[model samples]
Target: MYALVDCNNFYASCERLFRPDLQGRPIVVLSNNDGCVVARSAEAKRLGIKMAVPLFQVQEQIDRENIAVFSSNYALYGDISARVMTVLEQQAPAIEVYSIDEAFLDLNGLETNFPLVEYGLQLKQRVYQYTGIHVSVGIAPTKTLAKLANHAAKQYPATRGVVDLSDPLRQRRLLGLLPVQEVWGVGRRLSRRLNQQGVSSALALADCDAAWIRSHYSVTLERTVRELNGQPCMALEECPPPRQQILCSRSFARRITEYRDMRSAIAQYCSRAAEKLRQQGGLARVVTVFIRTNPHSQLETFYSHSASRMLSIPSADSRLLSATAHALLQSIWKPGFRYMKAGIMLSDLYPSGSFQPTLFDAPESPAAMRLMQAVDNINRSGRGQVRFASEMLSSGWQMQRNRLSPAYTTRWDQLPVVRA
Candidate 1:
């Protein structure tokens, strides 16, 4: 059997973990720069606050309902996700971290006289007790079927946030009710196409001939069809794949026309991207920089451009990447336009120590490597003091996070308070 464990309202739950006062409030976490609604609590959903709705569009309801708003804090959310994944790693013999908010657990080998449903409940309780984050568990025979079970768990209150599809009758009934689009790997376009072909529900698609489906679509959809029929084609990946590309980007709180600010933003982006690269132990040969004026703003001239540069040799050194990104930014940057966002992209990544060095290009110095490693370590400890000279002293382009809670877990000063 397989189990899909997913955190419920992950971003909002993370926010609420710190602020208990927001337990029953209409909480909505915004996207980069507090621009749009990304995650909303169940209460917020009742208010018809759709995901990706701009804050300005919902400001009236936000003020009227006293909605608790927050800007996206990737740092805090990332830390919380790590904590949750740690708990899962401790419990599950094998786990595939499907996303920051979800994972797949292999439950085949465990000898439990207790019911699997009871075991799933226990796993859920342990995660909640340890991290104070609520998660739903769905157990099934296949990965795709496990996803449907998870969906049912979320949709029906009777499931109590846990569903088991080991029963054939339950599996059949659930598949009959589930729309094709709701099935894993079936998007809107594919669902519409399937609907045209009389494949309306998951049951219908599962009943379709696998060879016929393979002829029409690809092997992946065929596999999904089989998986929906209680066959497990996709195996749980115990280790997630290394990211093929690293991108660091964010929208500024306010539009700026200054080239210096753009330079600073690009450098910061490159620095952060380099940090991720080193964490993954990968080196990049291609660096791309891009900037754009807000297309949604009628007052600003719409301009967007991107420039890419190939490094003479692949490197993960922050200073070198920052310099390359800055030069690329300068080439694409234009004056008299209000720039809303800028980003850095590193691609063609190779393993850090095994990559071939270019003939004419110099490899990173031993001292530079040691310095960056130490810098990463210091920053990991919550002291973000090590930064490039070209980088701004403060994030002038920082997102608007007026309602953000403190870094309760990561920062010493922001640790939770408890009464004895």
Candidate 2:
């Protein structure tokens, strides 16, 4: 058996974890630079604040309706996600951290001894007790059905955050009612095609001929069908290898027209990417820097620009990557255009200490390697920031004015008060 565990209204829930007063209020979390609505609380959804609605388009509604809005704080979200995964690992036999707000657990051994429905609710209650974040759980014989059951648990309040699809009648009733697009692997185009074929629900698609699906929609669709029918086509994979590419990008809170600000932004992005690379035990041979004007603004002259540079050595060192990224920024930064976003992309990644030095390239010297390690250690210990030459700007390119709630769980100064 498999179990799917998903956080409810993840970003909004993370915000609520700190600001308990905001509970039951209409809150929406914005995407980068407060561009659009990314996540909303149940109250916000009730107010017709649709996901991805631009802030400008909804400004009047937000103000009139008294909608509480927040900028995305990934630092806080990442910390909370780590905590959630830690709790799950302690409780589940095996867990696959699927995303920032979802995981899959192997519940095969426990199913025979315990009632699956009861077990799912116990997991939810324990998670809530530990994290103060609500979660929904679904247990089924296969991953696809587990995913479907999870959707059902999230949708219908009667389930009370737990759903099991092991019963044949329950599985059939749920599948018959689920929309085509609600299936695990079905996308917009596939849903339209499925509807055209009169297979408008999950049960109808699952009953379709496997050969026709394989011939028309490819082998992947066939596998999804088989998985829906209690065969596990996808195995639970944990601790996959580090990524081949890492990208760090964000739109500015306000458009930047100054060269120095652009430089600072690109440098900061590269510094962040390098930190992630080191954390993943990977080094990059190339860094690509890009800057652009807002694509959505009519008054803004459209400008999308990027440049890539080869590193002297494949390195996860922040200083080296920041230097290269700044050089590329100098070549691309324009004076008059109000730049919307800047970013860094690291590619041709390999595990650190595994790559051989190229004949034409100079390897990182012993002194430089030691300095990098020292910087990383200092930053990790929170003694100071690990910064590079390009990040030496006094304060330009800092995340635009953040009126954020305190980091109640992650920061000492921001801890909540409790009565003894």
**The candidate that achieves the highest lDDT relative to the unseen native structure:** 1
TM-score of 1: 0.95
CA deviation > 4 Å runs, candidate 2: 296-300, 358-370
Candidate 1 yields a Cα-based lDDT of 0.88
Candidate 1 lDDT over residue span 1-420, tens digit each: 899999999999999987878989989999876778999999999889999999999999999999999887787899999989999999878999999999999988663666777888888899999999999988999999999999998899888889999887899999999889999999999999999999999999999999999999999999998998899999999977889999988889888778888888788889999999999988899999989988888876799999999887788889889888878887887788988888889999998777767687677677988888999999888866688877874466777788778888888888989879
- Which stretches of candidate 1 lie above 4 Å from their native place? 296-300, 358-362, 418-420
Candidate 2 local lDDT, residue 155: 89
TM-scores for every predicted model = 0.95, 0.92
Instruction: Name the 10 consecutive residues with the lowest summed lDDT in model 1.
Output: 109-118
**Which candidate number maximizes TM-score?**
1
Q: Please write out the lDDT profile of model 2 over residues 1-420, one tens digit for every residue.
A: 999999999989998886767877899898866778999999999889999988899999989988888888877888888888898998778889999999999887897788988988888988889998899998898899999999999889999989999887798899999998999989999999999999999999889888899998899999999888888888887776688899998777777888877777777788778878878888899999988998998987899889998776788877778878888888887788988788899999988678887798677676766777787788876445767666776355566635466666666776789769
